[model samples]
Target chain A: MSLTRLAIKSLLLRPARTLLTIVSVAASVAVLFSLLSFNSGYQEGLQKQMQQMGVHLMVVPIGCPYEAASLVLEGGEIENYLNESVAEEIAGMEGVAIAAPSLMHAIVRPEDGRTDIYLGVDEKHLELKNWWRLNDGEKPGPGLLSEDDAVLLGWDAALIEKREAIGERIWVPEIESEFSVTGILEPTGTQDDGFFYVPLRTAQEQFGLEGKITAVQVRLTDPSMAAEVADALDARFAGVEIIRMEELLGSMTALMDSARALIFAIVAVVIAISGVGVLNTMLMSVFERTREIGVLRATGAGRLHIFSLVWTETLALTVIGGVTGLGLAAVAARGVEAVIKRFVPMAPQEAMTRFDPHAALICVLAILGVGLVAGIYPSLRAAQIRTIEALRSE
Target chain B: MAIRNLWRSYERGSETVHALAEFDLTVQPGEMVGIVGRSGSGKTTLLNQIGCLDRPTTGQVIIAGTDVTALPERELVAFRRDHIGFIFQLFYLLPTLSVAENVGMPMLFARAHDRERVRAICERVGLADQMTALPGSLDGGDMQRVAIARALVNDPALLLADEPTGRLERQARDEVLDIFDDLRADGLAIVMATHDLEQAARCGRVIELRDGRRLEHAYEDSWPKAHCAT
Candidate 1:
C-alpha cells in the first residue's frame, strides 16, 4: 500500500523491461567496480614489491634500464652483462650500504616444458634479500654464499627437483656440474621462490663467464641521497646505467594512471548509457500508466506522490543493479586480472584486483547518483500530467 | 455541496467548445444524485469539477463551506484527499495492487493508513473474501467494488462517480447500486454520472444534459419537484 511497494509492483508489471534496464546498469557498474579494485590492488602490490626489494638502485649494462631491471628481478636471461668490478666500485661509494651483484641465467629445457633459472650471488646479495628464510630443521648459518659447490634451492625449485633435504645434490645438465644443496629457502611469495642460488665464483667458473654479472643491486645508507649517489654512479661508470627504484615506481604508476584514465572514460560512457536506459524505461512506464496516474490523482494523490512513485522505481532499479554488479566484480576478479596483465606493463605476480569495501561504497553512491539524475525528467512528466487529460488518455 | 455558474471550455483549432456551460446544482447530505446524458454530454466534465480533478473556467464549488475553486493546487489536493472521493466508470483499479491495497490507496496518499478501516470498507463493499486478490484477477463487479472501497476509505463528505457501472453487467451493476444505497443512507452525499436511464431513475434526483447545457424540458417532465438550481 506504500508508494515504494506500488512502484516496485509497477516495475514488476513489465518484467522484461525492468530486468533489461537493471542488467545494463549492472554492466556499467561492474566495469567501474573492477577498475577501482584494480587501481587499488595494483598500487598496493607494486609498493609491497618495491619495499620487499630492499634495494635503492640498480646498475645495469647500458640499455633500457627498466627492461633490464625487470628481467633481473623476474629471473630472465640477459643479452649483456656488467663487470663484477662494478659491485666493488659501487660498494666503495660514500652512501652505498650494500652492493649485491648477481648473474642471472635461464636454462630452457624445451623437452621438459619448463625453464630453470639460476642466480649467482655473493654474501652481500643475501643481505639485500633479507626476507629469505631457510627451511625448517635446517641450521641457519652464514648461508651457502661462501661454501664451494653449495647451492640454495628456492621452495618451488626444491619441490620440483625433489631436493627437500640438506646435502641433496642436483646435477645441472646445461652446466655439466653437480652441486650439493646447503639449504632450502622457504616460500617468499616472489620470483625468488622459483630460483636456484649458487656461489658467485662457482657459477662464473662453471658457466664460463668469469668476472661478469648481470646487474648490481645497491642499498643506500640514506635513501634520501638516492639522486646524488645515482649521479655519482652515472658519472663514474662508463658502460652502466643507474636505475633508481623510486623513479621506476613513479614511472610505472604514471603509466598505470594513464591507462586508468582511459578505462575511467569508458566506464563513464557506459554509466551514461545506463542512465539513459533507465530514463527511457521509466518514461515508457509513465506513458503506459497515464490513466492509472489519473486515477491516483482522482483518489487524492498529489503531484509529489506521483513523482516519488516514479523516482522510487528508478532508485530500486539502480540499487539492485549496483549490488548485483558488485557481486559480479568479486566473482570475476581473477579473470579480469589475467586479461589486464596482457595489456598492462610490469604487472605484479600477485593478484591485481582486490575487493575493497570503500570502493564498493563509492560505486553504490555513484549508481544512486545516476538514479537521482535519471529519474528527474520522468518523475516530473508523471507529476505534471493534467488529471483530466490523463484520465482521457487511451 | 453546491456548484454555481460552472463553465468548462476548450479551444479546438480556432473555435471554442464549451464542455459545460453555466451549470449549477445543489445536493443535500444523505442524497444520491445521478447525472445522465448521451456521448459528449459533459457528465465526466461535471464530475471532474466537483471532484477537484479539473478546474471550471468560471464557477464556484463550495463543499463543507469552503470554496474549493479558490484553493491553491496544493491545498485543493489536500481538500480532495480529506473531503472528496471518486469512482471511475472503468473501475481504474491499479492492476498490480491487491484488492486490499487498492482500497488502501487513498489512505496511502493521505499518509494515514488504517488497516481496520480498510478491512471494514472491504467488508462493507462485499469484498471481504477478495481482499488479497489482484485487480487483474477480479471480475468487473469485484473490480468496481474495490474502487468503491478505495473511494470510501477516506470517509469523505461527498463522493463523485463518473459512469460507475457503465462497464458492468446487470447483476454487477445492481450490486454496486446496492452499495451506493447503503452509503447514501449513512448520510454521505453522492453524485454519479451514468448512461443507464434505468439506473439514474433510482436516484433521489436525476439531471440530464445536452451540448454542455441542462435539458430543462427533460428535467421538468421527468421529475416535477427537482431540487437542482439550473
Candidate 2:
C-alpha cells in the first residue's frame, strides 16, 4: 500500500478526532484567505475606480482652496467654470497628448422627493475624448444634443430609470429635461455612473451660461511627465487649479494599502491559532500510538521512515484543510461583496470579490510547511522511544 | 548460543525491580527449548534478553558470535530485525495487516533472500486459506499460528515465543504443539516460554525460573517420565 493510504487509514482509526482537527485547521486557513481576499479586492476595486475617473490631470477654476479641491477631487457641483479656449493654450505646450474639456455639474432632487442626479457634458469640443471610452456604441455625434433630441446616459442612470429606454426619450425631472437616450455607457462604478451626458453647448445654454466650461482633462503621451505637465498648466492658467491624476491615484492607493495591511495582521493571528491545532493533533496521535511506534521500530523501520510517516499524516491533513478552506472562502466572498456594495456602492463592478487562487496556493504551501515542522517534535519523541520498553508497555 | 550470568532489571521510577538475576543457559542450533516460570518469575525477561529486546545489566548474551550488548542502539535495531523472531502471549499481530501480512512482517523487514519461502512456511502453519484474514476475526489458536508463522518466516537463528500458549485452550494448545513439532523436525531452533508443564516437557529441554533466577533444568533424559506427565 502507498504511504498516503497508510496515513489516511491510520487517521481513520480515530475518525472523529482526526476530522475535527482537519476542520479546525481548515477553518483557520479559510479565515486567513478570506481576509486576504477582502483586502486585495478592496485595494483593487479602489485603484480601478480611481483610474476609471480619468488619470493624469485635473484642471479646475480656482477660488477657495477646499471648494476648488473638492470640485476637482470629489465630484463637487458647479461652483466655478474653467473655459475651453484656455485648454488650447495648455495643449500647445510640451508633454500633452490628448486634451478634452468637460463641464462638471450635479442636479440634486429629493431622494425622499429631494433632487438626486449628477449631470455631465458630452460636447463637440471634447467629443473625440481621451477618457470617456465608448463601451457600447459611438459617442453621441456632434450636434446630437444641439437640436434638443439625443442624449447618452451612463448604465446606472439607465437602470435607475426603471426600464429599457434606449432608443426612447427619458426625463430627468430634477433637471426638467426630456432628452432621447441614444446609448448606455459601461458600468465603471465611479462618478461616471452617477452622471448623465449632454452636449457641452447644450449644458451651458440650458444652465443659462454661455462661453463657459468646467475644467480640462489632459493625458500626457508619456505618463512619467504628468508632474511636468501639471506644473506647466498651473503656471500658464493664472487662477486655474491643476490637480494631477497621479496624485489622486496615489492617495487612493495609499488608503487601500493600509486597509489591506490591517486585515492581513488580523488574519495572521487566526492562522497562528490554527497552527496550534495542527500541532495538538500530531502530538495526541504520537502519545496514543507509542506502542505502535515501538513495534514499527522493532520491525526494522528507520528513523527517517518514522519521521516521514508522521510528517505525511500531518501534511496530508493540512492540504485537505487548505483546499477545503479555499472553497468556503470563495462562497463567503460572494456574500461579502454584496455587503460591501451596500456600503461602498462605487466598488468597481468589474473587479471580482473572490478568493484568489494565487494567494490560496501560497497559503497551502505555507500551511504544509507548518505541518511538517509541527510533526517533527512528536516524530522525534516517537523515534526515541526505546523499543523494548515500548513493546513491553501494558 | 549460550548466556552465562545474565542479569537485568526494570526501573520505572525510584523503584528498582530485579527482573532477572543470574542465569545460565545453553541451546544448540535447531533445538527446541521451553522456559517455564511463575507469574512474577523472569521467564519472559530471560527470553527478552536473548531476543535482543532488552539488555543484561551485568552479564553477556552471546548470539551468533556477536555480544549484542556492545552494539549501538541503531545497529541493535538491525540485529533484532534480522536475527530474531518473536511470538508473544497476546499474539501481537499487527491488527491492520492480513494473516499473510502478519506472517510476512519479519521476512519483509529482514530483507531476506526468498519471500515465497516465507509464504510456504505460513501455509505449513495451517493458515494456507486464511492468508487474507485480519487478526481481529481470527480464533485464538489461529492467531497463535499467525504469530508462529511470523516467528519462523524469516528463518532466524533464534525463535523466541513468550507464553505463546497462555491465551489458548487445551485443544488449541495441542494444535500449537503439533506445529512446533513440524518446526523442530525441520531443524529450526525454537525457544518457548510457558506456564504449562505439559507444554514445556514436549521440548528437548526445559528450564524453570523463579524471581529471575534459574532453578531447574529438565532434559529429555532427565524428565524420563515426561510422556506420563501429559
Candidate 3:
C-alpha cells in the first residue's frame, strides 16, 4: 500500500471527525466566496452606474446635493428646484459643452397607493444621456414639448402598471391628467427602467412650476477642464452646489474599498478559525495512531515519510471542503439575488452576488495555504514521535 | 553483528536511569540468539537500540561491519530500512490494512518490493490463505504470521523481535517457533527477547539481563541450549 492510501484509510477510520473537519473548512471557504462575489459584483455595478450617468457635472440647490444625487440616481423623492434660467447661464459658461436641464418628482398613485418616479427632460437631454434606448416609437420631439399630452414609459413602469404603453393612455392622479405614451424605454437594469419620462414644458405646466428645474446636467468640452469649470460655476452660481461626477465616483470607490477591507478581515478570521479546527483534528489523529506510527518507524519508515502521511490527509480534507464550499456558495448567491430582487427595489439590478473564475482561483489557493500551515505542527509532532515511547502508548 | 559498550539513559525528574548499561554482544549468521530477562530488565531497550529506533547515550553498534552509531539520522534510516526487520509482542499489525497490505507496508517505505514478491513472502510465512483479510479479523497466530511476513518482506540482514510470541497461545507459540527455526535454517540471524524458558531453550545462545546488565547462564533452570554455528 502507498503512504497516501494509508493516510486516506487512517482518516476513514474515524468518519465523524474527518467529516467535521471538512465542514469547518467548508464554512470558511463559503464565507470567503460570498464576500468576494459581493465585492466584485458591487464594484462592477457601480462602474456601470457611473458610466450611465454620462454628465460630467451636476448643479443642485445649495445644502441638498446628496438629496439631488439620490433624486437622479435612485429616483428618490425631492422638493428642491432651481430656476430654469440657470441652464442658459451654465450653457454660456467657459468649457461647457451641453447643459441639459431636468426636473424630478415623486407621486403615489391614488388608485394603487404605489410610489413612482416622474422625470422631465428637454429635447436635448436624451442626446446627453447616451445609455437610454427606445424599445418602440421615437422619442417625444419639440412638437410634443408644447402639447403636454404625450409621455414615454420605462420598461419596469409598464410592467408595474401591466400596460402595453406604446399607444396606451395612463392617468397621473397627482397631476389629475391623462397622457398617451409616445414610446417605451428598453430596460437598462438601472434606476432608469423604473421612471416615467415627459417633456420638460409639459411637466413644468402640469406641476405648475413653469419656470423651475430640479437639476442642470453639464458636459465639459474637454473632461480635463472639469475642475476649473466646476470651480467657476461654484463661484458664480450662489445658493447652488456644483458636483463633479468624477469626485462623486472617487468617494464612492473609497467607500467600497473600506467595505472590501472589512469583508476580507472577516474572511481571514473565519479561515484562521477553520485552520485551527484542522490542527485540532490532525493532532487528535496523531495521538490515536501513535502505535501505528511506532510500528511504521520500526518497519523502517523515516520521519519525513510519517510527516508526509499526516500532511497529505489534512490537504485532502481541506481541498475537498473548499470545492464543496464553492458550489454551495454559488447556489446560495443565486438564492440571495432572487430574494433581494423581490424585496429591495432600490438595489441596483446588476449588483447581485456573483463568483468569477478569478475569485474561485484565489479561494482555492487560500484554502490550500491554510491546509499547509495548519498541518505543520501536527505533522511535525507525528514525525518527531519516539518509536519506543509511541509503542509503549496504549 | 556486534554491540560494544552500549548505554541508554533517560532523565527521571532529578535523577538519571540507565535502561541498558555497558552491554556487549556479538552474533553470527544462521544463529538464533535469545535474550531472557525479568520485567524492566532492559531487553526491550536493547532491541530498540539495535533496531535504530532510539539513539544510545554512549556506545557503538556495528551491524555488518558498519558503525551505525556514527551514521547520521538520514543514513541511519536508509541503513535500518536495508538491514533490520522488527516484530513486537503485540503483533503490531496495522488494523486498517489487509494481511497482504500490512506485510507489504515496509516495502512501501523501502521502495523495493513487487506484488509477486509480496505474495511469495506471504506464502512463505504460511498466510497465503489469509492475505486478503484485515489484521483485526485474524486470529493471534495469523496476525503474528503477518508480522513475520512484513519483517521478511525487505529481506533484512538482522531480525529483531521483542517478545515475539508473548501474546500467543501454546499452539500459536509453537507455530511461531517453528517459523523461527525455518528462518535460522535459511541462514538468517534472529534476536528474540522472551521470558518463556521453553522458548529460550530453542535458541543457540541465551543471555539473561538483570538491572541493566547481562549475565550468561543467570537462570538456574535446567534448559537445553542448541549449539551455535562457528
Judged by TM-score, which candidate is best?
2
TM agreement with the true structure for every prediction: 0.82, 0.83, 0.79
Better of 1 and 3 by TM-score: 1
- What overall lDDT goes with each candidate model? 0.87, 0.72, 0.83
Score residue B146 of candidate 1 by CA lDDT.
Answer: 93
B6 in model 2: Cα distance from truth in Å? 1.6
Clash pairs for candidate 2: A56-A245, A108-A115, A109-A114, A109-A115, A109-A116, A110-A113, A110-A114, A110-A115, A111-A114
Q: Which candidate model has the greater TM-score, 2 or 3? A: 2
CA lDDT of A132 in candidate 3? 71
lDDT of 1 by residue, B107-167 (tens): 9999999999999999999989999998989899989999999999999999998888989
How many backbone clashes does every candidate have?
0, 9, 0
Candidate 1: list runs displaced more than 4 Å: A59-124, A130-141, A153-216, A220-225, A228-243, B217-230
Q: Give the Cα error of residue B171 in candidate 1, in Å.
A: 1.9
iRMSD values, candidates in order? 0.9, 3.2, 1.2
Ranking by TM-score: 2, 1, 3
- Estimate, for each residue in A151-196, the C-alpha lDDT of model 3 and write its tens digit: 7778998888777746688887667899887777778776778878
For model 3, the stretches where C-alpha displacement exceeds 4 angstroms are: A59-149, A154-179, A183-196, A199-242, A335-351, B9-18, B218-222, B225-230
- Give per-residue CA lDDT, model 3, range B117-153, as digits (tens): 8899999989988889988898898899999999998
TM-score, A chain, model 2: 0.76
